[model samples]
Target: MFSNEEMRDMVCVYSTENFNGRRAHRIYLEMYPNRRQPDFKIFKNLYDRLGETGSFHHKRDSAGRPKTLNSEQEEEILVRVAENPELSTRRISMETGVSKSTVWKTLNKEGLHPYHFTPVQNLLQTDFPARQDFAHFCRLQQNADPMFLNKVLFTDEATFTRRGVFNFRNKHAWDLENPHLVSERHFQHEFKIKVWCGLIDNYLLGPFELPPNLNGKLYLEFLQTQLPNYLDDLPL
Candidate 1:
């Protein structure tokens, strides 16, 4: 003795699960073992309607509870959000002629959630060809020798600083000579010392200090001198 809307809801679920209407009615009956099943003709009609519309939701009833945002308005909200992801919820509400809460619910249902911004390094125009060539070479090496990666010596240069971490409040000193709180800041410009290092298999190599005015020839000489010592120690 289910109401018309309740019967329609069951029919919708059935049609979605079992695409065939006749089979859906049998399963729907099995869903409620004790209760009397609805008429097959009515169930078939609802199933047909569901197939045509491809929607499980019941149609908006004029006499029933009023809808703040109709299907068309909800779709409009999705479109606006897609066009500009940075639009705020309030802005989306205004654009779609719906309330903020409605806009939020719509977006939530669509698996869209708010996220905070994060900073990352962007690729330069010159990097594209280099990246592609590196990838191609790696693929060729992978095909030629599976253990090629283990044989490679990865090297890079990084800087270490003598400056200790200090907040804005500590940077200022209460010296009466210069009440403006200015001090000789050597760490601001010349605190960093650059060093080069290499890694192979399980061994860590030298953190060799680079020359004060390092150039391409100096770098090549540095590598030529340092790499042989590390490579000789490698296991056969």
Candidate 2:
């Protein structure tokens, strides 16, 4: 029937055996405004025992990111990743209900090189093997089967563009931006390209050019004239 606000005692209690005179309206806040909830209940202990609740809140540090991954969680992630080869690490994490970071740390610690693919490595110590080269129907065919590779003439074409020369990397190298590397640098400026046409057996064909500026007649004539010289008279 009475609200929390209206519950304040309208008149203060002054124990009197015989009630007399006008009752005083309590003005002191020491007397709770809402008798419904007094200081004793709102906050616990002595500051409140003295009838004062003090400040409602205090300042604290902001939330922070966790410092490190737990070992067991990482192991679980590694096991799941190994079992499901079709699934990526992120996908494996979702399936196993473990964190992706744990999976990465586990993989790294296990010496797994996610980028490299070599069956010999077993991804180093990682549960997943680096690669498993499956033999399909095409791979089983004579042309692809290693035992019969010598007999089949695997032919291919090569064209020369005489403008770009390929370069092999040096035995030792450093980052281009490093001061030590920059001071000991060497730059190449060569323009000599030569392509070779060949059978996989190392029998190479010519690196001939098309006419300097092609014309239909010249192209056809070159084919007719050069075809004989290049192909040589076979048992035709």
Candidate 3:
């Protein structure tokens, strides 16, 4: 590898005559006939990109499968991932002092795969007891009666909107060119509607539209008035 100082000297030599890359490269060849020089294409691209400092830039290794991680580094990266499954490839790269691509390759070679972070509603410590109680109740009911599910009513409320959110990491569009192209959405003016529904046995009921800023009174009214109408009209 040429030192940075040697690269500066080379740049000076190439730029002395204000010559184009091809002529400079020819001149360079004549000057150092015994030294192996980069291809004309590479030299041209470097000059076009870096100008007078082209030779100061290190040459990239385009040869097949250049090794970035040694056995020890590979093991260290694996251990880092094993300790923290949530560590992103970028984070792993920073921690292990390697490029993100190297970290990713190391993980894949060891049968590990990258995955996007999944979003979920956060539950507090207090919520766990309620969840456990609901699970226990369901288990007991299921144990007591084989047809327990048939007698139960399941209800939920949801919102519909003109806008939607998605994880770009989990989505892909394949095309001839760069397949990882991104799409931007504009939602300056938005509209949404809230709805409630219930299901029992073969009955799928009321996607009833709800008013804005629903409270206990509105919910109780819905349970008392709209829910009964749906239940009364249940299929025999």
| Leading candidate by TM-score | 3
For residues 1-236, write the lDDT of model 3, one tens digit per residue.
33444345445555774746567667777887765453333333434445554433433333443346654455456645654677898777666577788887877876778666677999999999999999999889999997888878899999887766676666787778886665656678878899998889878888889986799999899889878887888873
TM-score of each: 0.45, 0.30, 0.61
lDDT of 2 at 160: 38
Clashing pairs in 2: none
Q: Taking the tens digit of each residue's C-alpha lDDT, what string does model 2 give over 1-236?
A: 22223222321221221111122113323354434322211222212222343322222222432225443344334434444444577775665455667666666777765664435522455433333332343367755566554444343333434342343343446666745532323346433333323343444445565555556798579667875576563232
Please tell me which model should have the higher lDDT, number 1 or number 2: 1
How high is the lDDT of residue 235 in model 1?
75
Q: Distance from true position, residue 89, model 3, in Å?
A: 1.9
Error of 1 at 168 (Å): 15
The regions of model 2 sitting more than 4 angstroms off are 1-67, 75-105, 116-153, 158-172, 175-196, 200-202, 210-228, 231-236
State the TM-score for model 1.
0.45
Q: For model 1, how does the per-residue alpha-carbon lDDT over 13-103 read when each residue is reduced to its tens digit?
A: 5667665656666777677665445444445555554577764334533342223766545655665565467889988766555778878
Residue 150 of model 3 has an lDDT of 86
Q: Flag regions of model 1 displaced more than 4 Å.
A: 1-74, 86-105, 114-131, 160-190, 206-208, 211-214, 234-236
